[model samples]
Target: MIRFCSRTKLVANLIPPSISISLEQRHQSIATIAKMSDSKILIYLMRRDLRVADNPVLHSLIHNKDHGFTHLLPLYVFAAQQIEVSGFIPEDGGKSPYPEARSQIGSFWRCGPHRAKFLAQSVWDLKDGFEKIGSGLSIRVGMVDEVVKGLIESFEEPAGSKVSAVWMTSEEGVEEKREERSTKNICDKAGVDFKLWQDEKYFIDDRDLPFEDPKDLSDIYTTYRKSVEPLREAPRPALPKPEKNSLPPFPTDVPPQHSPFVIPTKYEEIEAALLKLINAQPLAKNPPKCPENALSVHPFTGGESHAQERLEHLITSGSITGYKSSRNGLMGTDFSTKLSAYLALGSITSRQIHASMSVFEDGSASDDRYKDLKGYGKGENEGTYAVRFELLWRDYMRLCTRKFGPQLFRLGGFKAEENAHLKWSRLDSPKDGFSKEQIQEIVERFLNGTTGMGFIDASQREIYHTGYTSNRARQNVASFLSKHLYIDWRVGAEWYECMLVDYDVSSNWGNWQYVAGVGNDPRGNDRIFNPVKQAFDYDPKAEYVLAWVDELRGVDELGQIFQAWTINDEERKEELGIADTDMVKNPLKRIDFKVNRGRGGGVGGGRGGGRGRPPYRPHSGDRWTGRRPSSQDQGRGGWYGGRGDRGYQTRGYQGRGYRGRGDRGREMRTGMMDKERDATADNE
Candidate 1:
């Protein structure tokens, strides 16, 4: 029921030939090990934590026996299919990816295209990970408890060795508790020994939790921070590659499809579907560079090998040094530790990374130590603690998610004040004298750099082409969307969730509430962004503006056409494509102020600007470099998302770029608009 673990080291050892061969066919030494008391099978029921390294359940099995091969019957059951098989794309377009399910307003709720694509891809990647290490993933469909029970029964039919034990791991929150209990029941019915390893905190164990139970958690983040600070470092993490030999044939029938290891399939499809959807929408123009292997959209590669690859790369390449300075920026790939998704998915446990960070702190966190560590490249003095602080923050969000359940899924609670504003925007005609078309008119104005709100216009383009923006821009945009555009905050949250590559459910929903004056801003800081002044301070030279805004291109003094659509004019010039010169010049500038163009008018009787988008630039050197390249590739894009999510990457921005599914949109931008502009620097 309980076991003390000094370490979760995974050691590799081969079983003696005597165990498999008859007594007459084996060497004396083989019999000695086979008869030795230590040989056993540890049934480590794999959960979200799929990696073989630093797996405590595996370590426990290894430590208990002295001579036997440490063979753990690791099992994973595929269950999402049970839920998805009932799939019918809703007529209202309740979902995405399939023929139905498309919602411009918070369509995010339905488990549609984005989710389907990602899940399928993740499952495949997970299977591959296991095979690479010489193990097989036994995927079983049906009730999880029943399937696991059958596995133990089958394993016991053989030697009944250590496989007789059911070694379980501790989990947090209600859902996890429920799942944990179900696992225990399976082991109980099978008369197997179930051991639960403790991982109380992300890196620290349960004994180290400052408090127990959700109620014990301090409501204030600062309080939790101060109390949890100066915590002990993680235990040394170690895992040997699994031995080459297979476990003895047990009575249990292992799931055929479940691989030894796999990241869920939700990632890739989500990435592709997202891209396809976005390109088709009026919002997107060109194709984007997609996520590589990109199938899972997890910067975390999902399996042990991929996780280590990133960790080693992180420390050796010196990406960890300038972290403090670049993390908050809105555009570029290296701006932040994109590993959060992997951590959440359980591809790479936080403890392993924590251990790796300590090694990094000594080497890269300080200059003197850097010189000592070789390729240390200046642990470069100071701010390593800041990185540590981020880890702590991640811990905090997890705590919050645990403490608050479906509440984290709510929307109307915090933004009540904006409720009225939301209502008016939907009206056919605003009592304030704007037409029902006002919202779209305003949205169009903002996108076209004609809103007269410089900041709003700049930010719109941020999402328009590059498909990203800074936290500052996000806050500004949300406020502008709510306070200025009078659009619902839910609409904005959905768009952000759909676009941001770094989108974290907790952080995204949490921040949206805070900004909309609903979640945690107790001070009620629901403020507005002065679009023009912000442009002066953040995008003053019009360089950022020049990168996105169609009309401002080539206008040496941007103010010359700051409000290009202000005066009555028709037949004005329009630059409708993404050319190096056009990106630098005119794409949309003329304003047709006439209520209705004089008799015999078409398209409202004005330059293309007044009637439609500035000019659908296939490649303005931002979102995409060209069209879908072909219809066969038409998938949606989200975050560095499923089948669809990837950032705006011109040929110039290719190196740190996402590997598009090589399909339509080459993984074009879709649901999650890849809005964290500061995450990746564009090629231009």
Candidate 2:
């Protein structure tokens, strides 16, 4: 990785811009001169770093005068290995035969509909950004190495100048590294330069770390944060967006027939092509739509423009000031900064967000108009600090991926030798205690949200429908699968890779290992989260559960809703209107185990529960039941009445426990209008 200071000096020495002419004017002159000669094309192979702003490669190319490249070709390739189906599936029995990317372990679509749509939207937005600055993005679908090789060959004609070089941002994934090596070999065979710019996705550059090597970095998050927090350059300032016409002109001299692949430039044509690719996957819907109920929780569009808007709103509205307290919130748009999806796809850089927060903290921002906000002028408070802390955690995961290499994706993870004693059920190994069919059933039940644990089920349903879930919910669900169910952690990780629109390979797999007692958790096996306790703690009124789980929506009491199995068949029929036969048909496959006596409890009751450890159970008495509001207080419009449930009224749905919507409820409904307006807008 290149240091920022060194990169700056290199650019200055190479370009040495004149005071008379602006960088854009110089680029225009160079572009005009190039049109008179044979075109020397430089290919920018864009991957995760999708945005044109704060892009090191683009910045370097635009500033440098004597780089020898006359035209810049921005190319994005949808890798075949990531998009094509791995194995065969029957076309008959109402099944589609089109290719889809399936996971090796769970057979889940590697790039599911939600992520596909998000990626497509991001690519289109990037194209727009480029066009606005006098360039265009060329997109193709194929093996990356083959695609690059084809482009090099196409430009080798007598009419075209020699292909100068191929540049791309470096990534740390095992597969990504492999692709890089293969592309380098292709470039070498053709005597072309292959350059990899250091990845600028993280808040802190790797070279600024206190440790010499990433492997020497601390495994614990707290230790790592403490070491780096004191550094003045922990989060460097963001690079400016390239000026208009600063980029070399797009290669317009080459005819369409000269290219190996068809390039669709129109928005409609691009959207249609992306839709075809996405729907080719099994179980994919016609352009995946977010569930009506999930609109409030995940009202997001994938782009740099939307990302900036969200960051601005969070800062200006003083929502980020209360982020530490409200971040664990199960529902609502402003509960947390929904920038993960944008960050994952590189719609916006982490440095941009960090810089914005810094500006807000210093009270220097023009839009920092809210004076009543806590920590408005404070250098670092709990809220702003917590956001930075999370960003550091993201950096740590990526660094761990680099340090651990292939072990990051292995079954036993980095500490494979120490985790040898642990036994997990694998689909391929019947000796591991579960048959292939049994393991399939377990995975399917969990994925489909029919496991009967209301907290886990609700969270599962949310991710399935909207491609999103809060961090609090994600931890609980991951723990439920890995620590509670004793399934292979890789299976859950791969499933998450398929479902989450914000999926990052390092974070997703690294977190799974941490939760499964095989990675960088100092607590190890003690990191288990009891679903029942988590439900009452994070979602006290059962509002989140009632929103997603349809079967539990009929139950009014918080305890009955969270623990539906506890309600008898007679009560189910009398109150919930659920028949015993219907219950039998869709049986509650609840896992039962002994409750903990105290801190150091009983043993040997369930799978993986060793000595001094009992299976998970809810606490006794009122703690589990929760506080229920009385019917007389309905007119007061508290938790159980009025606007609480009326938020869902716009969608023609209402919880059984809440009162009917009224005129007053409609006026109070504006509070919930944060998401309503954005939800109706077409983000894609």
TM-score of each: 0.56, 0.77
The count of backbone overlaps in candidate 1 is 116
RMSD (CA, Å), each prediction? 15.0, 15.8
Residue 575 of model 2, lDDT score: 63
List the global CA lDDT of all models.
0.44, 0.65
Cα deviation at 464, candidate 2, in Å, is: 0.8
Error of 2 at 84 (Å): 4.8
Per-residue lDDT for 1-684 in model 1, tens only? 323132211111243444576545444443443333234555556555655556555444445555243454556543331113212222354432222232234343222333334333444555566555555455443346656776665544422333557655665444456667887887777676777776422644545667888667665556776676563343235444444333332223332332221223444433443344433344323322232221221223334556576766666655656666655444445555556545544556666666666666545363443454443433323334445655555565556656765444444432334233333243222323443343333433443334444445555555533334655567666655544444445556655554443345556655665555555444333243433333433443454544545444534433333333332222233342222322223222222122233443333312222322121112112121111113332332231111211111111111121221121111122111121111111110
> Residue-wise lDDT of candidate 2 within 1-684, one digit each (tens)?
423344244333434478998877765655453343456789999989989887888888877888988899999887656654221112232332334456666666677767777777888888888989999988776668888988888777533455789998899787789889999999999999999889787878866887888779777766777788653348777878888899888887543422333456676665555556445543422222333454547767777777788888888787887787777788888887888888887788878888888877877767636455666767766677667766767777888888888887666676763433344555544223334455555566677776657788788778877778888788778777765566667777877877788888888888888777678876555555666656655676677887887656666655455656556666565665544422223333333323454665543222223344333453322111111224552343211001111001111111122111121101111111121110100011
- Local error of candidate 1 at residue 355 (angstroms): 3.0
Worst 10 residues of 2 by lDDT: 638-647
How much does candidate 2 score in TM-score? 0.77
